[model samples]
Target: MGRRILLTCGEPAGVGPELAVKALGCGVDFAWIGDPRHLPAGTPVAQITAPDAQVPPGHLPVIRHDFAADATPGQPNPVNAQGVIDVIARAVDLVGRGDFAAMTTAPINKQALKEGAGFAFPGHTEFLAHLAGNVAVAMMLASTNVSPACRVVPATIHIPLEQVPAALSDEVLEQAIRITHAALIRDFGVAAPRIAVAGLNPHAGEGGTMGRQEADRMRPLLDRLRAQGLDITGPLPADTMFHAPARAGWDAAVCAYHDQALIPIKTLDFAGGVNVTLGLPFVRTSPDHGTALDIAGQGRADPESTIAALRMARDMAALRA
Candidate 1:
């Protein structure tokens, strides 16, 4: 049997509704967690006419939630922020309660969500962590051979650059490694995963000329993990770590900071990157892109990233089940 995937159309003004429509059109057994009224009128929806109504092809199953305000393409209204949070909260509840197999989320605007609804947190990963009762998690961006792949987290996230050195601790690095290792084995099905760790400073600190974080902090954790028989490498130079030749040798690369990992993957496949949250009890995946309010309803939004996210969510659900 196919998994029941729950898709949360995060921000109504963005491309979420359009992507949901497109994915349903492609004939996936998924339910949309958002306002049905947000969908263009006359859109084909796969609503069960009765409790036992048979689902048909070319129709989307919508679990409706109404937005308080009307959305315009290229325009973001803070008033609808709570609506975005509500959709995600509902999907999370469904997944945690085992009502759905997995969830694929659309992009959301943090600023709009905060200003409109008083949401606190930098982005989805943090919000998910809070929603899950503050479980630790890491973000990974994935792509096929045609594009670059990367998984990243700073020893500290959402902190100012000056605070990174103080924030980089041995305990945090070890936890990140453990979470990443588990993700490779369980979620990705890698029998033995090779993980490469990037250094915090330029040229991997140039043997302390650049900085001492690698030698003082990161290297010790890598050595400990290696001693435990994990297939891991590095404190490799971040600048040289992401090219094809380097990435070909490893299953995943861990960077010291956010941009260190995200820049490469986003550069390689901006339109198709899938942001996967590692270490979650339930399967959750999202597009790497954000809600593009400027082009939301213009009908010009590309569905590639959302499509990738849906496919990934489906695969992860099957793997978990």
Candidate 2:
């Protein structure tokens, strides 16, 4: 069994709870791990003691994690930061123990977490990696609505553009490819994952005219992978790779930096993208977007991403099973 899926409510001050409430009957069964007070008042909720506990029909099953105080619609209280982080750790512990199928996390506020708990780590991906004994992981943004699903991995993420060139090392690119490749097979059930890599420079260095990273740094690694029987097309112009016809050729696209990989997917399926963390020992995914503090308690949060994430987790769990 892949275990039962659990939803780790992210920043309670944000739209995490709202999204969780909206996800009640989105065609999936999962326990929500967070403070019940964070949910919109009057929202139907069934408190459960564990992941496998029976849930009342027509209600969201919540494994309640109490917060320091009641959440204010859009005002994030630093007092609740530790509680927010605790929810994630709780889900990880359960999932790691094989008691949960997978965890679908809502968005988190990094600043709130840091200011409140001295939490260190860029975001969920790195933090989760640390909790899992520092296991390596890659962030993948996948379009849930798109047929064939546009999936991408940024080789160097959460780094400044100025730092990208120096950060895009051969080891980094190789790990990203290896992890993505392994996940495609283990989690997505893809027998042969064809990958397309984007070049660092305009037009893929245009034979070194635009930039040498593609020609000097990238091509050789791709050559080695190809020699190892990995199907890869790389050093290609990033500008022309995301179109439907181009995307259809590859199962996933690996880009040199963050925006190169995220922009296209977010633009194509803004509300339906699922942020997946590959290379983890267990299955994990989250909504592609961030904590929307401005619209926290408005009941206006879009549930598409969260719903899609739940469905994706279920499918991945089956594949893993």
Which candidate has the highest lDDT of all?
2
State TM-scores per candidate: 0.93, 0.98
Clashes per model (N, Cα, C within 3 A): 3, 2
TM-score of 1: 0.93
Residue 218 shift from truth in candidate 1, angstroms: 1.1
Quickly count the clashes in candidate 2: 2
Candidate 2: residue pairs that collide: 3-101, 4-101
Ten residues in a row with the worst lDDT in model 1?
46-55
**Model 1 misplaced regions, further than 4 Å:** 48-53, 145-155
Expressed as tens digits, the lDDT of each residue in 1-321 for candidate 1 is 335778897888888888788676544467887877777667787654222235676777877778898777667788889999988988888788777788889889888888988899988988998888899998888874243355554445667778777776887778877888888888878789899988888999989998988888788889988999988889999888777787777888877777777888888778878888888888899988888877777678787787788778878777888
- How would you encode candidate 2's per-residue C-alpha lDDT over 1-321 as one tens digit per residue? 435689998988889988988888888889899889888899788898766878768888889888899989788899999998999998899899888888899999999999999999999999999889999899999997776679999999998899999999999999999999999999999899999999999999999988899888899999999999999998789999998889889999999999999999999999999999999988899999989988888778899999999999989988887
List of clashing residue pairs for candidate 1: 46-60, 74-293, 78-116
Model 2 residue 244 CA deviation (Å) reads: 0.5
Residue 3's lDDT within candidate 2 is 56
Candidate 2 segments exceeding 4 Å error: none
